[model samples]
Target: MSPKYDDVRNSLLGWLSTGLREEPSTAAIFHQLCHRLVDYGFCLSRSTLHLRVHHPQWLGTRIIWVRDQPHADEQTVAYDVEATDVFQRSPFHRVIHTGKQVRQRILIFGPHIFQIYEELREQGHTDYSAWPLDHSQGRRHLITFATDRSEGFYDDEIALISDILPLFSLVTEIRLKNQLARTLLQTYVGPHASEQILDGATTRGSGVTVSAAVMMCDLRNFTQMAARRPRDEVIAILNDYFDLIAEPIERHGGEILKFIGDGLLSVFPLDRPDACDRLMAAVTEAYDALARRSPLDHQIRFGTGVHVGEVMYGNVGSTRRLDFTVIGPAVNLASRLEGMTKTLQRPVLISGDFVKAANCASRTEYLGNHGIPGFDDLMEVYALRIDAELHAR
Candidate 1:
C-alpha cells in the first residue's frame, strides 16, 4: 500500500466492511466516505462526494436505482434520480450489466433546471471516473470519484481504486441490494400518500409459501382514539405504533400483512416444524410490550391478540391491485383471539388452538370458552403472563 492510498485506507476499508456487513443504514458510511475523500485530495467547490446506490427488486430480476447524501451539487443532489433525465437512459443499466467501470458526461446546450455540467464548468470540474459494485444478490452500484483536474482520471488514481475495486465491489453490491430492499419497503410498505402501505399491494403470485402459522393482533380502543384525535395525528400515531409491532415480527420470521387502523394484521409462516413455536415467543413479546407501553408515560398503549392455525399462503387480490395475506381458519382464529383481549382484560390473549400446539404447558392459563362477536359458538381462549414469565419452555 503506497502513501497516497494510505490516506483513504480507513475510509475505503470501512465502506468495504459496511458493504460486507450490509449495514442497515448507509448514511454514516457515506458520510465517512465524504470526509475521507476530502482527506484524499477530492476537494471540489461543490459537494464533490456523491454516491449512486442501487438494488434489485421484483424478485431479484428488476434493478432499482437510488442516490444517497453528500451530493455532487448542493442545489440538486437530494433531488429524485427517477425524475432525472439521466435515469431515462441505460447508462447505469449498462454499467451494472457489464460489471465494468463506465463514465458518462451529459452536455446541456440550453438552460436547464439542474445544470450540473454548468456548475462543474464554472467551478472548474472537467473530469470524472467511476467503478461498479455488484453484490451477489443481483444488486449493482457505482462508486464514482470526480475531480476538477483538467487532465482527467490519472493512471495512478485509476489503478489505486481498481486494485481495491474487487473487494469493494463485492460488499458494495450486498450493501446496495439490502438498501434496495429497504428502499422498496420504504416506498411501498411505508405510509406514503401515493403508496398503499401494504407490503404486497402491487404485483404478487410470483413465489410460493408453504404452510405458515398465522398471527393477528388487533389494537383495542383504536376506533375511539381515532374519533378523538386529529387526522394527521392519527397517521403519526399509527406509524409509531406499527414500528413497535414490526420489529418483533421481522425478528421472529414474521411479515406484517396490513394495519387495519389501530390493529396490526401479521403472519408467521413456517416451512420448518418449529414455526408454531414462534406463537409463544410472539405472545410473550406482545405482553412485554404492553407492560412497558404505559399510556401515561408513552401516550400509546394497546392490547395484543394471537392465535396459531394452519393455512395456505399466496397473493390474494384483483389484477389491478393484489395483496399478500394468509387465507385459512388460522387467520380468523388469530383475529378472534385478538378481540378477546377486551373481554379477557389481559393485554395479550392466545387461542386454545395455539395453546394445545404450544406443547409448553405451565406457561399459560387456559381461559374457558365464551361467546365471541360474530361467532355462533362460544370460543375457548387462554391468557399469557403479564410479565417476568417466559412463554417458551
Candidate 2:
C-alpha cells in the first residue's frame, strides 16, 4: 500500500474502535465512514450495506449512502428467505452464495451483467464492487461500493478495502447485537418497563409510589375455553383476547404492568391534570373496541375494573427472580372489582373516586356501596352499562 493509504487504514481502525466506547445509530456511523472513504480518494459515489437480523416483523435493514446527501437512509424489509428473481440475478446474491468478492466494470454501451450496472453506468459510475461476509449460522451480510471516476478502482484500492472488511464486520455485528437486545426487550415487556430495566432498576424492592388510574381486566370463561380447546387453539385464543384488551390501553397511553393468567393489570399515570378524564375515556373505548370484535354467540367475554389511587410500582421478588408491577390497595381493589363482574354480571365497574376525578358521575349509574375483602370501609362503586347484546355475547 502507498504511504497515503496508511492514514486511511489508521482512520478506519480508530473509527471502528470508537464504536466500542460510544453508541450511535448505525446509519450515522455508515454515513461518516462514507465521507471518510471519499476523502481518502476511494472515489465513492454510492455505498450500500445490508445485515439480516432476528426479528419478527423485519428481515433486516439496508443502509444506503449517496454522495452529496446529508445522511444515510435506512430501510427495513419483511423476512423472506426465498430469493426473488431480481435477487437471483444480482451480484449481491451471487457473492453471498459463492463467498467471494466481486469487482466489475460498468460499461456505458456494452452488455451489462445486471440492470443496476446499466443504471450505474448511465449515472457516470464506472466501477462496482461487492463484498459478502458469510457467517457459520447461515446468515450473510454484504457491502457494495460504486464510484463515478473515469477509471474503476485500482487493484491496490480493492485490496485495501478487502484487508479491512473484517473490522467493518466486527463493528457492525456489535451494533446489530445492541439492536436485537432493545427489539426483544420491547417485544416481551411494555416499552416503559423496558426502559426501566435498561436503566438499571433490576434489583428486588426497588419501587416507587405513584398515584394513577389502575385497571384490571379478566377474560370470562377462559378457564373453560382452555380446558376444552386444543393446546394450539387455547394459545391462539389467549393471544387474540389479550390483543383486544391491550390495543386500546396502549393506544390511550396506558402501560400494561403484567399479565396474570387470564387477567392483565394496566395503569394510566397521573402526571397531568386531565389524567382522570383520559383514563376513563380509555377504559370505555377499550370496552367498545373489544365488543366490536366479539362473536355474536358470546364465546369471548371480559370484565374490567377501573380505580384511581396511589400504588407501589416496581421490582418485587426473591434475589434470583423479580417482577416489575404494581401492588397496593388500589391494585387490589381493582382486581377485586374485576372478580365482582362475574357475580353482578356486568362488563365494567368504576370506583367513586374515578367518577369524581373524571367528572363523569352523571354518565355512570350508582351501583350502591360495596364491601371488599381485606378493606375496612364499604366503597361506593359505579357501573357503565353496555348494550344488552354485548353483555350476552
Candidate 3:
C-alpha cells in the first residue's frame, strides 16, 4: 500500500469527525467528504458527487447514506425519489438477504441503469458504490458513493466503509425504528404528547410536589360507529376528529397520556401548574370541535371531562412499554366525569373544581352534586356552551 494512502485515509477520518460531532445532516457531510476525497485524488478529477440516505427500523447506531455522481441530466428529483425507494426495500430484500453484512460489485451504472448513471452525471459523478451506513440510535442508513470517473470505490475505500457498515446499519436501524415508533405514538396520542413517551427523555420538573389538572375525553359511541361504518370511513373521520380536538390541548401546555381505545387520557401540570390553564382551553376545544368536522359524518359526538387536584406524575411503566402517566384520584375523577357526559346529555363537561382551578372567564353552568360509583361524592360539574366559549379553544 502506498504511504500516501494512510495520509488520505487519516485526512478523511479527521474530516468526517465534524459530521459525527455536529451531525450536520447526512447530505451536507457527504458533500463535504466527497469534495475533499476527490481533491486529494481518492476519486478521479472532475467527478460529480451525489449521495442519498435510507433508514430502517431495525438497524441502530449509524445512518445509511448512498453516494453516486451521475451525469447532470440524471439527478432529477424523480430520480432521487426512486433511489430512496430502492434504499428502503434494499435492506429487506437485497442487503439482509445475505445476512448482517453484504458487499458485492455490480455494473449498476450500465445501460440498464443508465438513467441512474445519468442522474449521477447530471450531478457530476460517474462511479457508483451502494453502501449502507448506520449509527447509534437504531437507524439503518445507506451511503452510496458515486463519482464521474469510470470504476467505482477502490478496495481501500471499500475496506474503510465495510469496516464501519455493519455497526452503522445496526445503529441506523434502531434509530429509524425508534423514530418511526415515536411518530406512531404521537399520531395516536395527539400533539400534546410527552417526551418520555416519544423522545424517551426524563427529568424531574422539581423535587417539590404540586397540584395539577387532568383531562379525559372519549368518543361517545366509537364501538357503534365502527360497527356501522367501513374501516376507511372510520379512519378518515377519526383523523378529522383528532385534528379538531387534539390541537387545542397542545396549543396550551398539556401532555396526552395515552389513547385508550377510543378514549384519551391527558394531563396538565405534569410538567408544572402552568398546565392548569390548559384544562379550560381543552374545554373550549372539545366544545367547538364537532362543528368544523361535522362534515365528516357528524353522528359521532365526544364526551370530555376535566378535573383539577394533586397527583404524582412522571414516566412509569414496563421498560418495553414505558408510559408517561398520572395515576391518582384526579385522573380517575376526570375519567368518571367523561363517563357522566353520556347520562347528562352534554358533550363538554368540567368539574367545578377544574373551573376554579383554571380561573376561567367563560360561562360554567353547574350540575348539582351527584355521586360517582367508585369515589364517594357527587362531583360538581359544569358544561361549557359550544359556540359561546371555545372559539379560542
Candidate 4:
C-alpha cells in the first residue's frame, strides 16, 4: 500500500474506536464512517449494512447511507434465511455465501448478472463491492459500498478497505451484541424490568420495596376448557386470552411479571406522576380479556382484581433459576380479590386501597367489608363500573 493510503487507514481505525465509544447511536457511527470514507477519496455514493438479530418479530436490521443525506435510513425485515431467486442473484448474497469479497464493474455487468446491477448502472454508479463480516457466535453480516465514478475504485483503495475491514467489523459486532441483549430482554420481560436486569440486578434476593397498584386476572373456565379441548387448541386459546389481557396493560405502562397457569400478575408502580391514571386505564383494559369473542363461537370469560399497596419487587428464586417479580401482602390481596369475583358474581373487583389511591370512589360501588384469610381486619372491596368507565371516556 502507498504511504498516503496507509495514513488514511490508520486514521480511519482511530476514528472507529473513538466514534464507537462516544456516539450514542449506530446511525451516528455510520454517518461518521461514511463521511470519513468520502474524505479519503473513495467517492462513495451509497452504503448498506445488514445485521442478523435475535428477535421474535424481526429477522435483521438494514442500515443505508446515501451521498448528501444527513443521516442513515434504517429498516428491519423478517428473518427468512434461505435464499430466494432475488437473493441468489444479489451480489450481497454471493459475498456472504462464498465468504469472499465480490466487486462488480456495474457498467460492464449486464442485467443477466442481477436486476440490482442494472438499476445501479442506471443510477450512475460505476462500481459495487460487498464484504462479508464474520462476527461472534457464527453470525455473519454483509456491508456493501457503491461509487459513481469515472474510473471506479483503484486497486489501492480496495486494498485499503480490505486492511481496515477487521476494525470496522469489531465496532459493528460490539454494537450489535448490545442491541441483541436489549431486544431479547425486552421481549421476554417487560421494558422496565429488562432495564433493571441489564443494569446488573441478577442475584437472588435483590429487591426493593415499592408502593404500587397490583393486578391479577385469570380465565373463568380455562381449566374446564383445557380438559375438553386438545392440548394445541387449549394453548392457542390461552395465548389469545393472555394477549387480550396483556395489550392494554402494556399500552398503559404496566409490566406483566409472570403468568402462572391461567392467571397473570402485573404491577404499575407509583414512581411516575401519572401512575394512578395509567393503572386505572390498565384495569379497564384487563376487562377486554373478558369481553373477547372467539371465532369458533366458544365462550371465553375472565375476572380481574386490582389493589394498591407496598410490595417487594425483584429477583427471587433458587441460585440457578431466578424470577423477577413482586411479593408481599399486596400481591396476595390482588389474587384474593380475583377469587372473590366468582363468588360475588362480579366481572371485576377493586380493593378500597386502590380506589382511594386512584381517587376513583365515585366510579366504584362499595361491596361491603369482608374478612379475608390470613388478614386480621375485614377488607373493604368495590366493583369497577365498566359503564361509567366507558361513559367517562
For residues 93-142, what per-residue lDDT tens digits would candidate 3 score against the true structure?
34323334433333434543334445555555545555435444443334
**lDDT computed for candidate 3:** 0.58
lDDT of 4 by residue, 1-393 (tens): 898899999899888867467565665677788889998887999998887886788788889999998879999867675446777778877887888998888875446477888888888989988998888777888888889988898888889889888888888888878888898888777788889999999999998999988999888778778888999999998887788778888888888888889999999999867777797787676554444444354555777889989999899999899988899999999999988888887777899888888899987899999987778999899998874222111
TM-scores vs. true structure, each candidate: 0.52, 0.85, 0.65, 0.90
Off by over 4 Å in 2: 81-102, 107-126, 133-140, 227-233, 293-299
lDDT of 1 by residue, 1-393 (tens): 567766566557665765436354444454445555556765422222223543222322222112233342322233355455765444444455687776533232554233444554554555545557655655455555555655655566566667766775554455555666666665443322113333443555543435556666655456787889898988887777776667777667666667776777766666655766765676567557745665464355566667665665555677777665556666776777766666667666777766677665577777788776666887677777666332121
Q: Which of 2 and 3 is the better model by TM-score?
A: 2
- The residue-by-residue lDDT of candidate 2 on 1-393, one tens digit each, is 877787778778877877445754666777877888888888889999887876768888888899998878888856775367777788878888888888889886788878778888888899999998554466678889988888888776787788777877777776777777778777766777788888998999997999999999888888788888898988887887788778877777888888888888988889855777776777677677766663653366788888999999889988998888888999999988888877777788888888887888877888999998788999988887666435523
Candidate number that wins on TM-score, 1 or 2 = 2
* Off by more than 4 A, model 4: 81-85, 230-232, 286-298, 387-393
Best by TM-score: 4
Ranking by lDDT: 4, 2, 3, 1
Better model by lDDT, 2 or 4? 4
What's the CA RMSD for each of the models?
12.7, 3.3, 7.2, 3.3
Window of ten residues with lowest summed lDDT in model 2: 384-393
